[model samples]
Target: MKVDASAGGSSQERSAAKASDPTSADAADDAGAKPRAALQDELEKLDERLKKLYEPIEKIFEEKLKPGLAKLPTQAQIDAARAREGEAARAREAEPSRADLQPSRTTAQP
Candidate 1:
């Protein structure tokens, strides 16, 4: 019990020492300011980098990708493929298998 009391008393003293020191407040303020300033600088750098990077990608999409997709598959090509598929389905249906015409036979069970 006495050991526990001393341990608690030391923690209270440590906190009191920190609260009494003016340099501790300055340290906390410096720590907070440094990270926020670094983050603001990084954010500005990333903003400029992303803007430069996206401009070429936007040009490639508008100039190349859009024109390529427009040239693919006219109306005549689609109609021809559909007509060929219809003829193949008709041919397969005209020839029915002999097994398909057979009837099932089952015995009665107890």
Candidate 2:
């Protein structure tokens, strides 16, 4: 935007003017930034507090639950087993079941 020197010419020269301009959206953002920064600082403090609170619980889980988790089959192992079973299951689906293959006992008269 071209402006006369009386209206503050360059962008760098207009920084103070824009900050003070209540009609400008930049002014509202500038006004809101201080509180947003304060809120960000407060949230960081709360996060640190929660991190301290959960530290012991996380350690206990790592010690206790982790051993049990290690004993369980890995996801890859589980997936391989499922894949093997899937082939068998598909074959079973294609073939008639044992009951369907058996002869019916009812004798019919012609």
Clashes found in each candidate (C-alpha, N, C closer than 3 A): 0, 0
Candidate 1 lDDT, 1-110, residue by residue in tens: 33533236678776765655646775568566989899999999999999999999999999999899898988999999999999999998898877787765565768
- Candidate 1: which stretches are off by over 4 Å? 1-30, 73-110
Instruction: Name the lDDT value of residue 30 in candidate 1.
Output: 51
| Candidate 2 minimal-lDDT segment of 10 residues | 1-10
Which run of 10 residues does model 1 get worst, by summed lDDT?
A: 1-10
Q: What TM-score, over all chains together, does every model reach?
A: 0.42, 0.42
Q: Which stretches of candidate 2 lie over 4 Å from their true place?
A: 1-27, 75-110
